[model samples]
Target: MPDLAISATGLTKTFGGVPAVRGIDLAVPAGSIYGILGPNGAGKTTTLRMLLGIIDPDGGERRILGSADPLAVAPLVGYLPEERGLYPGMTGREAIAFMGALRGLSLAEGRRRAVALLADHGLPADRPIRTLSKGMAQLVQLLGTMVHEPRLIVLDEPFSGLDAINQQRLEGLIRAQAAGGATILFSTHVIAHAERLCERIAIIAGGEVRFEGEIATARARLPSRVRLSTKVADGAWHAALPADAVLRDGVWQFQLPQGGIEPLLAALIDAKAGIETLAIEPPSLHEAFVAIVGAEPDPVAEALS
Candidate 1:
């Protein structure tokens, strides 16, 4: 069995009599990339805050890094908040070193690490935060968060402002971190990032978790897809196709029924249908997410742009 980096039971929070998070349980395994997925106003940030001990939970309990008190294990955790906060006058290196100091590093060691980290990412250590572009500053802040080399990294909406190029870089960084044995927990409404990066995921909607487990399990909630294009315009095999199948551009596309595609193929072969092409595609994470959480605005597309 794998160790849990974060464990929460019936965690709940409220503000002004309106529930922000309601009885959400999370178990993030050690040394894996985990994602909390939800749309805007889905209590993602609130839950993170509670787990980090930045805010008190109205009910339930949480244990982070095996400690009931998150503050006690603060040095083992690195956090990049949804809201960007960096001193305008501080140089990139200075900002990073300062964060490291807060995480228990000596000032001199922090500065040394900051210089190395900034240079590694192609940023000038001496450059002031205000002088850097928004994207550059974001990267600098991220480097600051990791300067102390915490065992677990938690990022809330880290992809919010990044363009495609930077997003890819961040993904690579995340993989690199996990490869180095750090557990990563991030919250995002952008489905594509979670699909690509997370091994385990929790889907939150309207302040509640609709599903939680392996990404493959979430995807398995939906059926596979089949696309068939035939030479024959009409045949008995048509009866074997799903009733919901749609024909578009001379191709028939539909969800495959459970059990297997063998039954469909056998039927087509028996009917003597002239088969031009047949394809079977696995269900996508987005499709499964939709199946679990219902239709949501195209936030992934919106986030990419």
Candidate 2:
């Protein structure tokens, strides 16, 4: 069996009287990038917090690197928070070094790594956090989170403030980290970004996970609609269509409810219809989100944004 980096079953969280996270289950594999996504307030951040031991789960269970005591296992995880902050008076190197120390690296080693990272990421060693651009500060924080070389990374909205160039760079860095044997969990609203970067994604809506699985698998769960253009007149193809098929503009289109399409093909062949072209357009994530989340962004996730 494959070793999982993080696993949670029936995870739950509450704020005041409200249940922020419902009994959600997560299974993130080692050396893979796991993306936690949702409309606003679907509880992505809270879930991360619980996994990091920053906030305890109200119920259920969680494990990291096979340990349930996340605090004890934290040394193996790197973290980038959604709410980013930096010491205004500290130089870029100093800020990075401080975070490394917090993650259990020695001061001297942290300094060495911080200096190398500053140069590698194109930030000046002497640049004060007070003078750096928002982007620069964000990058510095990222270096701090990663400098310790943990086995798992929980990044909350790592793409929030990144420009196009930085976004691409960050994506590459994330993939590299996973390649190096860390499980990366990042939260983002950019569906295309998540689609491009994550091997699998979980969409949480209404404080619960509405969907989870590979992108292709999720797409398969929904019915597939096909459009075909043929020689028949607009209304003439209806009689020959398979059950539940609809005709529009000399084209027959409908979702294959289940099972095989052999019957439909046989019907078309028996009608003596010469097929021109047929195409299946899969539903996109956004369409699936609307279908699963009730046509609106989760209120909390929106507020977090």
Candidate 3:
């Protein structure tokens, strides 16, 4: 098996006598981008806190960077929590440098790195964080998270408040970090972000992990959809179509056959059916998530209640 930056088995947590996370398992491969995908209040934050040692799991075990105690490897991990904050009076550079100092980086080196990071991202480093826009402030904090050049990066709802442009920029930054040999794990409710970035993902609902594995694996749980248009539909080829095939808006829509499309293609050709168009679409991540989790109550809210 490949090296793992983070691993957990049967992790569980409770808040106020109510279950918040229930028997979660995860294996985050080194240098890979993984995602925890779920709706709001799905216990994502609780699970992450447990893995990072900020909160203890009620049951199960976790290892970070080959160490059983996550705190022992603190300097190697960078984290941006869902709740964002920075000293309002501190300049962007100072804020970043302070965060780096907490992680054992020298203030001078941190400031230097902060300058370069801000310049590269077209953000102002000398201005007080309170004077910056919300997106800018968030980006500064994210830069702080990376100032020490951590081996693993964790982001909680990282894209929650950004506009489309900033969100795209953040996505690019995530890709660049992963390219630089950092293991990145982020939690987000937006399916599009996870679909675009994650090599593997865990889908959570009702405080439980409903699915986990490669994105393609999740998508493959559902059959590919086939849309075919033919001039001669009333023929032997009709027998090749699926039993539930529906003809609507000049197209025959059905699930791809288990035997594959080759047999159907042969039947269509043998019957001289004039195939106008044929398209096969695999299930999207959104569709897979819905199929796995259905509609569940917000676990965090339930816990609070």
Candidate 4:
């Protein structure tokens, strides 16, 4: 197993006597992309804030980058908050350099790295942030977050407000960072991004963890499906299918049996049924997420307590 980049045990938080994040455990391995997934108000942002030492947890403990005091090792961690914060009057280069400076980079070294990062992302280093488009400015903020080359990157709602094209760009950047051996921990209510990028994930619901494990394991909670279409619409072979099978769009779709598909295949063969199509469909992350969390929560609910 890889070394842990972030670990939390019994982490809890509350606001005005109301629990926002109940005791939760997390283990994020180094060099892996881990996602904290849930709808709004699931305590994702609160949990991240506690883990990053931005706020004190009401209970439990957290270790970041192996340091008991994450604030002490702040230089080794990069954070992109849900609220986009960039000085409008600062030039793109200055903005990036400012972030690097906070992480212990000298002004001169920060400027040097900022220039290269701006050019690499196709942003003009000298352009003031006020003159840049919203998407461009957001990218600039992300560049600033990464300018110091921190070992662990924590982002809250990174995809929020990004257009489809910019969202795709962000995804590529995340992959590139992980390829370079950075351990990334990001929280998102948007499930698709996590589904595509995460190796492991923790699902939060009602301010508590619903599940935590490999993405494949979460998906395995739901059974695979088999859609079969036979030459004859109704036959003895139909008896071999589960009682819950539903015929839709000229195909009989049902959950695969526990023992295996072999029994069903054999039963069909014995009935001498002419089969036109037999397709097995694995459960999707969305299906798994829904199964774990039940109905989706309100999208605009407050995630922070």
Candidate 5:
């Protein structure tokens, strides 16, 4: 087994006598990108806080970077919370340096790193935070989270407010961080980001984990779907399709059989059903998430409502 950067077992927390996280467990492999996915109010932020020791759990245990005490390993970890803020009067460079100072980096070194980070990411280092756009300010805070080059990085809803272009840029930055050997754990309500970036994911809803493991494994919980279009209205090939198959607009749709599609394809060919189009699509992360959580219109929209 690989070394774990963060691990928790049965971690529980309640706020104002209401449960926010219930018996959550996680094992994040070092140098891997892991996503904690759920809808709003699904305990993702609470679980992240407990793992970082920002708040004490009502029950269960957790370890960070091999230490039972998360605070003791603070300098090795960088975190960007769900709520974002920076001193309004401070320049982008100054804000980054301040965050670094809080994590044990010298102010001088922090300033130096901030200058380079801003230039590398195409941001103005000397501009006051108030003057920057919302996305730019968020990016500035994110740069601060990495100024010290910590071994592990944790982000809560890092992509929440960004526009499409910035969201893509942030994804690239995340991939770059993991490539540099830092373990990244981020929480997101957006499935597409997790689908594109995470090697493994944990799906949480109603304060509990519904699924966890590789993207492929979660997707495999549902059978592949097949969409086939034929020129003929009726033919012997119809029998070759699964019982669940339905015809609509000259197309046949069904679950791919357990015996696979080769046999069905041969049968269709023999009958010369004039196959116009055929596609076998694996279950998407969005579909798997819906199946697991029983949410419609996707979790993000459902959560907002």
Candidate 6:
């Protein structure tokens, strides 16, 4: 096992006596990328905020970088909240320096680092943040988050307003940071962004952690999808498909049938129709997300049936 970067046990919170986050437990290893995924109002942001010490957890304890008391370890961490805030009156350089200073750096050192950050992140140095595009503004914030050279960085919705090109750039930067030994914790509704970067993730819903584990482990829990294509159409062959098979564009796609693939493969071969191609689409992060969150329906109406 890798060195632990963050650990929280029985972390709970509430708003107006209503439970906002249940007894959630999470662990992130050093030098790895971790993602928190959930729908809107699922308390992901709230959990991250509490972890960053911007807000206190109503119950339980959170340890950062091995220190169970996070407040004493603030200098080793960097955080970017979901709500982006910058001094509109200040130029990009000054705004970034201000953020760096808040994280414990001299004004001169902060300004110098800010200038270098512009070069590193490919941002215009002299432009005021208010005059920049949202994508540009997001880049500036990302730079600010890393300006102080912290070993642990947390970002909330880092790709909210980025274009395709910018998103790719940010993704590359994240990979580079982890390779250099920084533990990254970020939250996003966009699952594809974490496809190649995240090693582990926590899926949250209704203020509770529904899932927490490595990306591969989460995927293993969901069966692989089977897709088939045939060179010849045979109505009788269609009848041989599993009852739950989904017919799409003359192709049959289905979850791993209850009997598994061997029986299905044998039946297809016995059908006597020429086979063109057979493919198994791996379960994507997006599909897993939908399966977990979308499973909760209105039971009041569903039970009436």
Worst ten in a row by lDDT for model 5: 296-305
Q: Clashes per prediction? A: 0, 5, 0, 0, 0, 0
lDDT of 6 by residue, 241-290 (tens): 77878879988888876567777567667876677777877788776777
Residue 149 lDDT in candidate 4: 92
* Runs with alpha carbons beyond 4 Å of true place in candidate 5: 297-305
Residue range 20-94, candidate 2, lDDT tens digits: 999998888888888887766678999999988999998999999999999998877889999999999999888
TM-score of each: 0.96, 0.82, 0.92, 0.93, 0.95, 0.90
* Residue pairs in clash, model 4: none
Off by over 4 Å in 1: 297-305
After TM-score superposition, the amount by which residue 55's alpha carbon in candidate 5 deviates from its true location, in angstroms, is 0.3
> lDDT score, residue 155, model 4?
94
How many Å off is the CA of 144 in candidate 5? Answer: 0.3
Q: How many Å off is the CA of 12 in candidate 4?
A: 1.2
Candidate 4 residue-wise lDDT at 270: 80
Candidate 4: list runs displaced more than 4 Å. 297-305
Tens digits of lDDT, candidate 3, 117-207: 9999999989999899999999999999999999999999998778778888999999999999999999988888888999899999878
lDDT scores of the candidates, listed in order: 0.91, 0.81, 0.92, 0.89, 0.92, 0.81
Minimal lDDT window, size 10, model 4: 296-305
lDDT of 5 by residue, 68-144 (tens): 99999999999999999999999999999999999999999999999999999999999999999999999999999
